[model samples]
Target: MKNYNKYARSYFMPPKTSMKWMEKEYVTKAPKWCSVDLRDGNQALIVPMNLAEKLEYFQLLVDLGFKEIEVGFPAASETEFTFLRTLIEQDLIPADVTVQVLTQSREHIIRKTFDALQGVRKAVVHLYNSTSVAQREQVFKKSKEEIIQIAVSGAELLTSCAAETEGDFTFQYSPESFTGTEIDFALDICNQVLDVWKPGVDNEVIINLPATVSLSMPHVYASQIEYMSEHLKYREHVILSIHPHNDRGTGVADAELGMLAGADRVEGTLFGNGERTGNVDIVTLALNLYSHGIDPELNFERIPDVLKVYERITKMKVPERHPYGGELVFTAFSGSHQDAIAKGIKWREDNAEPYWNVPYLLIDPTDIGREYEGDIIRINSQSGKGGIAYILEQTYGLDLPIQMRESFGYRVKSISDHLHKELGSAEIYTIFEQEYINLNKPIQFIDYSFKSGEQFETMIEVKKDGVIHEFTGIGNGRLDAISQVIQSQLNISYSNLLYKEHALGTGSDSKAVSYVGITNESGTIYWGCGIDVDIMTSSIKALFSAVNKLILDQ
Candidate 1:
């Protein structure tokens, strides 16, 4: 904050104005995606991927439904050249997929790039030249006309090479660092390149505009894209593409707004891997469309697999909080958020809603191969009763009563708070069993038999202080009858016996689980849980567990 005067805005604006992209609410369709991981992403890595890793990643991109993949700058290195040759010679490239390779405006580089494409079925020869003002003034020391000549010469060379090449090939040109170049000059160079390629409907050309150095807000990039889209030559035959970097941390935003501004293709990498921050993340961009009900065409159903491959090959860790694909993106650790999400899930189930409207979740995690039990409601000291009860029902099928859930919730939170660590579902269940379910403390229920005629009558046997005894009592219900016996035999006083039960599983082998709660003389509530093959036995065990808790408290 103290060094504010040292930096100035380095971005340029177009002379003409068009704000039409602002009116659009969202991208309505998926764009043609090109993964540049082998080229831009590989070059940025401290230890670039080897040939085997590159092959593995290429197959991954193909499986993910990318129609175009920039394999590498084939003329740049032997590894790149060998990889391209290998894909072509071994017939590993799919019939519907196109491989693209980058080249400079120089003739020999263009020639070598074409040689790498030899024997390939379909390919894109991407040509690029720096057109930014800073590059023209300081880097190249050339005028605008000279830069145009470089692009034109490259376009002419590509035309001649394609005529002689055996494989089917297309042309793509980029005014490198387009965002920092004058919009009119950028348009001028691209139009000149189009003059040579002569793009037609049958052989459409790709014109890529790259934010080589991102230097402005996303709106400025959108406006620049709109200007080019409106004025580019042979617009019908040209596929407008954008390649945005993340120097300013707005690469995703720039790509999205640029797409809404009429660009048809995006060139990026998985997880946005590139130089100086990174390229726009293809995963984020495509999933953003998926979340809005637009089919992204890419398959990310098993995103965990994708993340594993990406990290294993690229040596880049996907942050735990990364959007849609991270570990914690769907986790609800806060009490309020967990309660809302639990209720929202139940509302959807009860109403059978067709769309996903759960609170704090834009899309269902299960859609992307994430689970609800562990991934959604993680329990910690910050969690609440709804989450704890939801975990119980989901993992072990013990639905606690509303009041009982709160009681168990506080108990679990206390243990977690004392240990200074989070509790897993199994750990929570173990705690529940230890503290509340079927507790055989000072008073233990050995067995119970009941007869219900004019009134419910029960005889129960229990062990108190290591001694066994029998007691008889009569009441309106089975649980009440047992409670009366415990009060008379043990000399304990309590009231308000509340109970709930549910079938834990299905078929003949299923078990029944029950919860019981009661109030002590001091106005405090005690809760218990029981699980057994018989519903009646589970209920009795739950009542005895609650009574033992009361006696232990006394």
Candidate 2:
């Protein structure tokens, strides 16, 4: 903060205005996605991936539906060179996919890049050189005319190499730090490279403008991209591309806005892994389009599987809060969020909603192989009645009554608060079983037989305080008759008994579950649950469960 005054803006605004990208609402179509994970992302890692891991990661990129992937700077290392050879030698590169290799404006590196591409069906010979003013002054110490010659000579080298090469080749050029370079100079270098390649419809060149160091907001980058898209030679044949770094934590924004500005391709890494803050997150960008009802053309249906392999090979973890691919991105722990999500899920099922419009969630977690029970609503001290009840009903098929749900919710929250940790579904269910269901103490159900007469007659035997007793009472219903017998014979006074029963599931082995609530003189209601094979027995047990709760509390 103290040296903020010394840090002036390094990025240059275009000399001409190109702001039409602001009119577009969102990206409606998928771009030519190029995963630079092996080259750009791999270089950033402290422990870079080896040849085997690189191969596995490449297959993952292919499976994710990327048509273009920058395999590596083959000329930079023996391992990278061998890896490129391995793909070609083994016929691992698909027929439709093109592997791109990076090289500088040098003869030997360019020749060795072509050497690694031998026997390949198709490949991109990428050439780059730094053109930024700061780089020219401090790093390369080259004038604008000299810098143009470096790119021109490299482009010429690529054309010559491709003429003698065995495979079909496409040419790509990048002004290494495009954003920091003046917009006019950026255009000049790219056009010079395009002229050497002489691109046509059949052989389009990719002019990738990288935010080598993201120096401004995303809008500025978009304007710069628009300026190139408008002025670049062979505009119809060129695939305008952007490689945005996350220095400002807006690489996705830069890519999205760049596409809106008429860039045709995006070069990024999965989950935005690369040098510094990393490349634009291709997964986020694609899925952003997906949530807007556009197909990203990339397969993210099993994001977990992708993440597992990525973390294992890259030795980097996707943050728990990372969009779509994170462990806790879809998980709700706040009471209000959980409640709304619970209601939203039920609303969808009840209405048979055809679209995803859940309150807090942008897309259904299941769309990416995440579930509602464990992944959507997790119970903690902050959980609410709706979420806890939803978890129970969705998981264990216990549709608790509304009042009972409120009472049970408090019990769960209190225990979770005391434990100072979140409770898993199994732990929550265990608590339910211990605290509410089939509680037998001070009063217990020994046996019961129900008969229908003028009113329902019940012959019931019960154990009260370790004593066995038998009594009879008649009322309008069987439960009423049992209640009358208990109140009179055992001298237990309770009223406003409410009961509900349901079949746990549809099967011969399925049992009946019943819930009971009894209000005492103090205006407090005690709740209980019972599960049995017979409906009548379950109800009787339920009444005794509530009675035991009332007695224990008294």
Task: Provide backbone clash counts, one per model.
Answer: 0, 0
Off by over 4 Å in 2: none
Model 1 weakest 10-residue run by lDDT:
10-19
Give residue 52's error in model 1 in angstroms. 0.5
- Summarize candidate 1's per-residue lDDT along 229-321 as a digit string, tens digits: 999999999999999999999999999999989999999999899998999999999999999999999999999899999999998998889
Cα miss at 231, model 2 (Å)? 1.4
TM-score, candidate number 2: 0.98
TM-score of each prediction: 0.98, 0.98
Which lDDT values do the candidates have, in the order given?
Answer: 0.92, 0.91
- Candidate 2, residue 158: the lDDT equals 88
Q: In model 2, where is the ten-residue run with the lowest total lDDT?
A: 435-444
Give the alpha carbon lDDT tens digit for every residue of 1-554 in model 2.
Answer: 58779989999999989999999998889999999999999999999989899999999999999999999999999999999999999999999899999999999999999988999999887899999999999998889999999999989988988999898888889999998999998888888888888889789888999998999999999999999999988999999989999999999899999999998999999999999899999999999999999999999999989999999999999999999999999999887898899899889989999999999999999998888878999999999888898889898999999899899999999999999999999998998888788887877788988789789988898787788888998889988999888888878898898888999999899999999999999899988899999898888888888988888888
